[model samples]
Target: MSLIRSLRLDPLPVVTTARVELRPPIASDYEQWATLRGESRDFLTPWEPTWPGDDLTRNAFRHRLRRYAREAREDIGYTLFLFGRADGALLGGVTLSGVRRGVTQSCALGYWMGQRHAGRGLMTEAVRGIAVHVFETMRLHRMEAACLPSNEASKAVLRKAGFSEEGLARQYLRINGQWRDHLLFAMLASDPRPRA
Candidate 1:
């Protein structure tokens, strides 16, 4: 790779399928982010945090950007944007958070998408791309994910990304408000990659 190409995550991998573009979120993406997320309020509330339904202000968006920047520097994990490649319309967000390096190089994968974008194979493709980026660019050893037992869609995504169904834990995570059971899935460096 050229020095500039090596220095930047440019050529951003576009990660396009027939309908989606999985790439890094930019400084100007907050507007669409708010729209898609806000619209999915009811659909996502059951699985995610209960934020104010219509409270995505510019200030909050700036705060999110600041956190993203800090996380990038600290190598916490990456939060990518999902969009329609042809028109560049925002769809949702995908994250690989809590990254740890050294002997136990591993990170946890997490993601959320708007209701309209759900059920398509876009997320599966996005997850595959994130796994590739994690193992190749970040040089991580393992990637793990937690999903509600009832979330078949999420389980499918992990399986497509080459994560094995490890086990189940009671009250594995606090979802929305109460503790919820989560199934654990993981992918090791030795695992084979999966196609979109």
Candidate 2:
């Protein structure tokens, strides 16, 4: 008989930093997540795929939660919402997606922050925390990230978090309604971390 594998993580993992906590988004988080995304629309839209007309609706959030749960159960991805450690304020979100195990143990990293939280080094902290989890807990070999070449803030965040620029991807993804080119970056499990 062939051995079977159980691919579920009960009570999804939560990663935390000195100032923030990152956990999967739950139904209780809907209002905060929606409010922050709504307020940051103009600040975020340029770097993101165009939002669905009902993106902030409760029904949409329910759909998102279901997908996140399914991906987690399949060991394919983890999407986490960041919150202030002290006040528990909603900060933003980060995701480790497109996970590939076996020969290519790697995943893609992506994140977004509220406009008000920008320029505070919070995203850098979140990225570092997630990188640790990806490397140590998940034992993944590599993590990749991509951003519009013009998004200098994102590039800086990736750099500070120990990811090295890899190259450019032509029209890698559709952002704000158009296919856009992106600068790619990657961090390997064997790479040295930038000292704090």
Winning candidate number (TM-score): 2
- Would you estimate the TM-scores of all the predictions? 0.87, 0.96
Candidate 2 lDDT, tens digit per residue, 1-196? Answer: 1122263434576999888899999999999999999999999999999999999999999999999987887778999999999999999999999999999999999999999999999999999999999999999999999999999999999999999999999999999999999999999999998765
Worst 10 residues of 1 by lDDT: 5-14
* Per-residue lDDT value at 111 in model 1: 90
lDDT of 2: 0.93
Q: Write the per-residue lDDT of candidate 1 for residues 59-134, one digit (tens) a residue.
A: 7777777787667656676777888777888878788789897888999989988899888777887788777777
Candidate 2 residue spans exceeding 4 A from truth: 1-11
